[model samples]
Target: MYGTAAHNTYAQNNVGIESPTRLIEMLYEGVLRFNAQAKKSIKDGDIEKKVYWINRSIAIITELLITLDKTQGDISLYLEGLYNYEITLLTNASVDGDVAKIDEVSNVFKGLLEAWRESTNVA
Candidate 1:
């Protein structure tokens, strides 16, 4: 338990020291992970888990959307649209129990994550 607490603190500190790009990359990774869990929950017939994980993904996407610099012009607008679309997809997936929607969102996030990693030169 003590080791786990120490690890958590270390992880938090590491994140605090990361560049802004890396932080965004982390958010993308988080959304991807949550979406995967949501997909698995659906496959396992765990409705509660499905909703929880999908909601988690949506929340992260919301955070990303809110953090966007609208003053950045076209790119920010484009990202806002994409993030909104992903949130809609996630909401519909949760309501309809649609695995395909989750897959679609996951793919979108994966692409974004890849782009971020490439741009930031993050492993």
Candidate 2:
């Protein structure tokens, strides 16, 4: 409980200090991490762990979808579709224990993360 509270406080502080672009990058990183854990859990035959990680990935994607600016026109729409697709893929991976599905979603997130990093001129 203490560790969880400390972690939450750390996360809150980081979020408070981060720029918008950095926050988005962090979100992508988080989804990637969750997907990796989900894949590993599936490999280890740990269904509960797999579900937990995949659900986390899905939640992040959903958050991204919710926060999209509709005024951005085609870009926002495209992102919404992509995020929804990722959520679907993650849900399927959780249900079917499909490592390949997790891999696919992770690869998509990797590409997005790299693109975001390049756009933000972040190392």
Candidate 3:
């Protein structure tokens, strides 16, 4: 009975069960979803929604960078000013309701994600 109850709790929480690759994949998918929503919001002429998703995407990217830095030892230099560039783009896109900057940063992240996945054998 104890074993069965423990298993039930584990299943409920799904903690300590997910693979790291799965975690990264989920983050990637979330960022992609945010970008898609941003595009849709732009098409619908909703500046607020666009900004919302763009901000969300930037937040995710920031988290990813943090994770990478923790695991990889100061990769901010490898990014080579890209982080600042993305922040500027994010700021401009949020202020101007323009999606071009957001898309550019999203593409940059997509490339980074792909490269990281490949290097980590998670792809």
Candidate 4:
């Protein structure tokens, strides 16, 4: 327990020290990872695991959507729409066990992640 607590504290500090660009990159990567897990769960016929991971992916997309800065202009608006659509896809995937929906969301995030890295020089 003590080691776990210390590790968590260290993890928090590590995340806290990153630039905002790096943080966004991490979120994008997290969504991708969760989407993949959700897709796998769907394929394996594990409804519970599918819902869990899809919800996780949706949660991250919600965070991204809510944090969009309108001051960034049209790009922010575009991202808002994109994130909302991704959430919808994930939600539908959760309900229907549709790996295609998950795949669509994954592709969007993968593109976003690549573009984000290139634009922000985060890597």
Q: What is the C-alpha RMSD, rounded to one decimal, of candidate 3? A: 6.7
lDDT per residue as tens, model 1, 21-113: 889988999999999999999999999999999999999999999999999999999999999999999999999999999999999999999
Q: Evaluate all candidate structures by whole-model CA lDDT and list the values in order.
A: 0.95, 0.93, 0.75, 0.92
Candidate 3 — what's its lDDT?
Answer: 0.75
Residue range 27-97, candidate 4, lDDT tens digits = 99999999999988988999999999999999999999999999999999999999998999889889889
Candidate 1 vs candidate 4: the TM-score winner is 4
Candidate 2 per-residue C-alpha lDDT over 1-65 given as tens digits, one digit per residue, 9 for 90 to 100: 99999999999998999999889999999999998899899999999999999999999999999
What TM-score does prediction 3 earn? Answer: 0.69
Task: Please list the residue runs of candidate 4 whose C-alpha ends up more than 4 Å from where it truly belongs after superposition.
Answer: 1-10
Clash count, one per candidate = 0, 0, 0, 0
Considering TM-score, where higher is better, how would the candidates rank from best to worst?
Answer: 2, 4, 1, 3
Query: Mind giving the per-residue lDDT tens digits that candidate 3 earns over 31-90?
Result: 778888987898899988888888887786676666665445456566635765776787
**Winner by TM-score:** 2
Candidates 2 and 3 compared: the better one by TM-score is 2
